[model samples]
Target: MTVLFWVCTIGILSLFLIWRNHSDQKKAKERFRDLKKTQYGASPNRNSGEEALSHVSHFFEDHRQENAIDDITWNDLEMDSVFARLNYCESAAGEEVLYDFLRNPCRLNASERARLERQIELLQTDGDVRLQLQYQFYMLRQRGKFSIYDYLHLLDQEKKRRNGKHFLLLFLLILSLVCCIFSVSGAPLFLVGMICVNMITYFQEKGRSDAYLSVFYYVLRLLGEAEKLERIHHERLQETFALEL
Candidate 1:
């Protein structure tokens, strides 16, 4: 009866989660459509804190070239608010890239400028292709409090993670399995104890590495979205962006 109850509970929870995901996706699509049609004015940038906003700027600040916009000019233009107005990006990573591009203001040659203009036109007119791409971007929501680049920087400074503890845990689990065949009662206790220890250790490592893991996950998501766009094969988009991904 308890087993049946758990099975039923799991089924219900799975259904609820699926339903919630679909509902969220529908809402996001609608919101994108509405914003595109109405041309909503930009509000102030979402600031978790001064520290977080600073972290978001780290990449652009660190990588400034000779031609990059000067701080004085940027502020004089109220570039932050201008960025807020221009940023239709769905992901924090997208926002970071846009910010960096604006900061570094590249000089596009005639061909490049024409290509960019054509891509912009496609995005404006091709609703289906635009929506498909936007949906993928929407899935990669903002990472509050810190940018992915910040997490990556932290990872670079940290010592490389070792697999020794994981190997030890696996060895113990195998030993416990062997003991189960020889001594059932003793083996059960040993196995349970080792399982508990493994759980504790796993959680400890996960807690310590969560930031690093999230950064990698976010990057993988961006790659996946790019891959999705590549598969779309929209003729005009192909000619314009020339997505090589």
Candidate 2:
């Protein structure tokens, strides 16, 4: 009787956790879509391709300057397309170059800085273009530098959950042995211990399984984000400096 009660309790808790994880994933996809839309609307000089992205970093750096560019001119820049480029191109120079540039656009030479300045100066003539680019640059610059360590930490957490699962299994196995011993010896209370062990084991496995799945999902998400950034860099670099060689 005790073992039956334990199994029932653990089964209920496990079901709840699985449902929660599924709900969270649905919410995540919706949020990412909205984020992509917002990023696109803030981009500049769509017709000019990646040339606009260099200006994009600048526009983000100084939002006040965004007012200098116009709406029509700003709309010409396709933020989504740049994002798509970042998503696709695998070349080190393509998407990777932009990430490298963002890591330290400050290291650029006097001539390079001057050229970017000249470009921005020209873009500022339009009110919408200037404002849109400024916002994007500001936000991205603040997103801070990417760190591999941070991602690694997320990975470790997932592993930790997986490791814990083994202990739960071992506990139930031991309890089962005790239950068998009690049955033969006519020890009535041993049934109670067996029940407790079964219930705890079931609940623990469910929780750990959900956590492991969540961690794997997060890893996939981060990779997708990295891809988005990469594509933008590749397309933009080609347009801005014809760096395709």
Top lDDT: which candidate number?
1
Mark the regions of model 1 whose C-alpha exceeds 4 Å error after superposition: 1-52, 107-110, 153-157, 162-204
Cα-lDDT of candidate 1: 0.79
Model 2 lDDT, full chain set: 0.48
**Per-residue lDDT for 1-245 in model 1, tens only?**
99999999999999999999999978877887776556534454455344645655777876788898998999899887777667777788877877887898774568877887888888878877777777778778888767777777777799887899799998998899889878867899899989999999989988998888788898898788888878886788787788888
Cα deviation at 223, candidate 2, in Å, is 1.6
Task: Give one digit per residue, the lDDT tens place, for model 2 in 1-245.
Answer: 99999999999889989998989866765564455446643533224345533333332333223233343543576443545444322221233345344434355689888777765554445444433333333223221122323333455565433546557656656766776776756444555665676678778777756544644554565555455434444333334433222
Instruction: Please give each candidate's TM-score.
Output: 0.67, 0.28
- Candidate 2, superposed: residue stretches over 4 Å from native: 1-216, 228-245
- Assess candidate 2 and give its TM-score to the true structure: 0.28
Instruction: Report the lDDT of model 1 for residue 121.
Output: 85
